[model samples]
Target: METTTATPWLTEEQQRIWRSFLGGTTVLMDRLDRDLRAAHGLSMPEYEILVRLSEAPGRSIRMAELADAVAHSRSRVTHTIARLERENIVVRGQCSEDGRGVSAVLTDHGFSVLEAAAHTHVQGVHDYLIENADAQDFIAMGRIMQNVVEQLHGKNF
Candidate 1:
């Protein structure tokens, strides 16, 4: 039988900082997602999924690998892919090397959509994050996020 260890809870100050971080990130993400969707009909997660697939070799990647790249669960990726597939923006194909492996491919129409949407998304990013933040703070934030990502996945990107 496996025994579970109880972790210590956050102190008042720690909790405040944690909540602040969570709140800020949540609000920022919501705003960005809203902007992207309003302008391009793509949720942030869907946009990220599409972007990753677009950048992949031959505009295709294994479903599992794509899920990992975007930090999405396999199931969530599948559901989102189904939606994209219905839109004719993406297609699923069997891997030639491994019969069991599935790959997501971005269609030409999808690429066109992404190219148009990226402009608006970048403008939204500039308005929400870049325009307001101090240069040093922006740099610091990138470093902090990079470190957190590295610690979590430890993958060379």
Candidate 2:
């Protein structure tokens, strides 16, 4: 009998772990988004954008760069910036060096909102994820995620 050259699919245990990771990540992010939205009116993506901008130089970054850092599409970033601009939380400024380039700057009010939301967000993370998880488990999770993210996104994004 001829044997197959191609490798077979995941073993049952491998499948179980992979599926658990997928489903758990989905649920965790969903819960986080919901909690942040209810408590702070900020989506997870928006919160990430704010955090990145807050830590960047002058509390601002070019629009395209911001999108890259957040792993969002340029168009999606624009839409998000528009919404934030409307809320007066973030401001868009023309890049003096490049007229076509725009920068998203987090306003003082935006910083305030982020600071306030951070407390609730952290508590939510602690309640939903950290409180139930062991330190070793948490570290393992980070390492696993780091490996996955590096493998998947390091080259492309």
Candidate 3:
């Protein structure tokens, strides 16, 4: 027979902090998404995809790799890319090195859109989170997030 230990509940302080973190993240993302959509007609996820592609060589990335970078499923990336393609922001191409692989190429129009939206996104980030936070606290928060990412990603607890 297998035995299992009961999980401990979060302490009061831990619960409070966790809830605050969750609420803050939701608010921050909502604000950023709203700002991006209002100002540049881009969703947060689309902006993220553009950022990733813009940073890639030749402003292109294999679709599977793009999906992984954004932490989205392949189907979601495909759907999003289809939307972007309709807007002339991105185009799909077969990877030269591998005929079976498809790549998302950021169009010139997409780069221009991203350039305009980047300013709003950066300002939103500063206004909502960075500007009000103490430098030491912000750095600590970043480190904490990094640790959480390392702990939760690609492994069982």
User: For this target, which candidate reaches the highest TM-score against the unseen true structure?
Assistant: 3
The regions of model 1 sitting more than 4 angstroms off are: 1-17, 154-157
Candidate 3 C-alpha error for residue 115, in Å: 0.3
Per-residue lDDT of 1-157 in model 3, one digit per residue for the tens?
8778889899999999999999999999999999999999999999999999999999999999998888888899999999999999999998897879999999999999999999999999999999979999999999998998778765545
Q: What lDDT does each candidate get?
A: 0.91, 0.91, 0.95
TM-score between candidate 1 and the true structure: 0.85
* Tens digit of per-residue lDDT, candidate 2, span 1-157: 9977898789999999999888988998999899889988999999999999899989999998998888888999999999999998899988888979999999999999999888878888988889978999999989988897778763664
Local distance difference test, candidate 3? 0.95
**Candidate that beats the other on TM-score, 2 or 3, i.e. the better one:** 3
TM-score rank, highest first? Answer: 3, 2, 1
The C-alpha RMSD of each candidate to the native structure, in angstroms, is 4.5, 2.5, 1.9
Give residue 39's lDDT in candidate 3 (0 to 100): 98
The candidate that wins on lDDT is: 3
Model 3 lDDT-worst window of ten: 148-157
* Model 2 regions lying over 4 Å from their true place: 1-7, 154-157
All candidates: TM-score: 0.85, 0.89, 0.93
Residue 116 displacement in candidate 1 (angstroms)? 1.6
